[model samples]
Target: MKRDVADFWNLLWEATLGLCALFALLNLFAPPQDLPWVPLDLNRPIGSATGTKVAAFDIARTAAPDQVEATTEACMAALRGADVQVERAEDTDDGGFCQVRGAVRITGGDVTPLSPSVVMTCPLAVRYVLWDRQVLRPAATEVMGSDVARVDNLGTYSCRRVYGSVDASARPSEHARANALDVAGLTLEDGRKVTLLGDWDGAGPAGGDGAVLLKRLRDGACRVFSTVLTPDYNDAHKDHFHLDAASYRLCATGPSRTRRAAADSESG
Candidate 1:
């Protein structure tokens, strides 16, 4: 009986130690960007589209083709479930890696409408909704004390190479595959406009509502987008936040280098 009790205690201690090790590793190797630190406003009203949905897990880039197709379906269903208004777009293969397997053009969500409708892969659209619902609206309310009425997207899909890369032979950009978006500004319910051009960094930081709102937006975008390039990232991105669902991750913020050409072009 003593031996049995001793064995039980040993197992218990081992379990505790294992848990501690896991937590320690999590603390050590966790991503530098943690969005959960900023809580969302659950009280904010959402639109009514209909259907129940489950949370999504990332579809691995190295997954089997079958898994990729199924994940695409699941993401589409999840968007409909969440009540995001999406229209299926035709398959686009601009050769190379610039193919859009399952693209969509989003019109609106439950309570919000995307102005100058953005188009992209269904998965990318779903990510947009996640950011809009989880971060954008709440962040707006938290920082500016107003609800977002319209989102002015710079755009999503564009048949072009990487925007700010100096290499002429650089690979096709996520925009080419409809896997990215460029956000221009947000219009609040109170008729206030929060934009990247008029607000980013010192331009908006002093006593400007646009700057504070832009800061919140940039941080929130970092949480949702795998690669978030801002006015701080490069001159080509000074007027818009370039967000993408790339396999790799990036979160950079700083003054952008000046460009001789206009940054509004999709390939800028």
Candidate 2:
């Protein structure tokens, strides 16, 4: 009886030791399981200009001070004369993109007319031309008829390559870096919706407003962005407008009267 009791205790000890070893090994080699989720709430309003929050995983852990300052300045400029309140700034790498997240409030716009609402995420150092400058400001003054609201986006921050290239599959895209944006359509405060793919060629109910607005926006984009691709350029951009800050020569391949004239003269 004494021998059996001793043997049983020894076996229990050995099993406990083995279980501890197994747990350690699993911890050392297993991938992390507590991945964080990115915040997508863009509707919250910020009350202060400077504050701090736990940095999101999508932001870089380390960012150059100049880069951060440039991004902040660009965002402020985009807001124009609106009262902007920046809540917090942090660097993180959440969605495989180098990004910065801070809450912002944009005031003084005609549509919605809210005060100090939160802006979720914007590209760093990439200045965004307001929807007015991109679409409405360029539209025929007569066509707008004094309706102020305009613009729609097809989401941003994609992880794929430029048009999904496999060979020479370079680093991730500008959207991944928060350096690119895609504009899809526009809407007026009077409830008119103008889409890029659907209404760009007078296919919507806006009576050619969509086509006119898209052309104007693309033309302005060529002036603002180093790389601008649109539906008229090729099949790769059949659905949306691609705008990026790459340092390449400005190429306006969209349906521009200036481009057509230049082509005609070169051919003539």
RMSD of each: 8.7, 20.0
lDDT of 1: 0.68
Instruction: Write candidate 2's Cα lDDT for 44-123 as tens digits.
Output: 22211111211221233365666555555555543443333333433335664444343233344433221122233443
Query: Which portions of model 2 miss their true places by more than 4 Å?
Result: 1-91, 94-126, 138-141, 146-150, 166-168, 255-268
* Model 1's TM-score against the true structure: 0.68
Under the 3 Å rule for N, CA and C atoms, how many clashes does model 2 have? 8
Backbone clash count for every predicted candidate, in the order shown: 4, 8
Q: Which stretches of candidate 1 lie over 4 Å from their true place?
A: 1-69, 164-168, 202-207, 255-268
- What are the lDDT figures for the candidates, one per model? 0.68, 0.51
Give candidate 2's TM-score: 0.54
**Top model number, TM-score:** 1
* Model 1 lDDT per residue over 39-82, tens place: 22222222121101112434544557577567667777667766
Error of model 2, residue 208, in angstroms: 3.0
Error of 1 at 243 (Å): 0.6
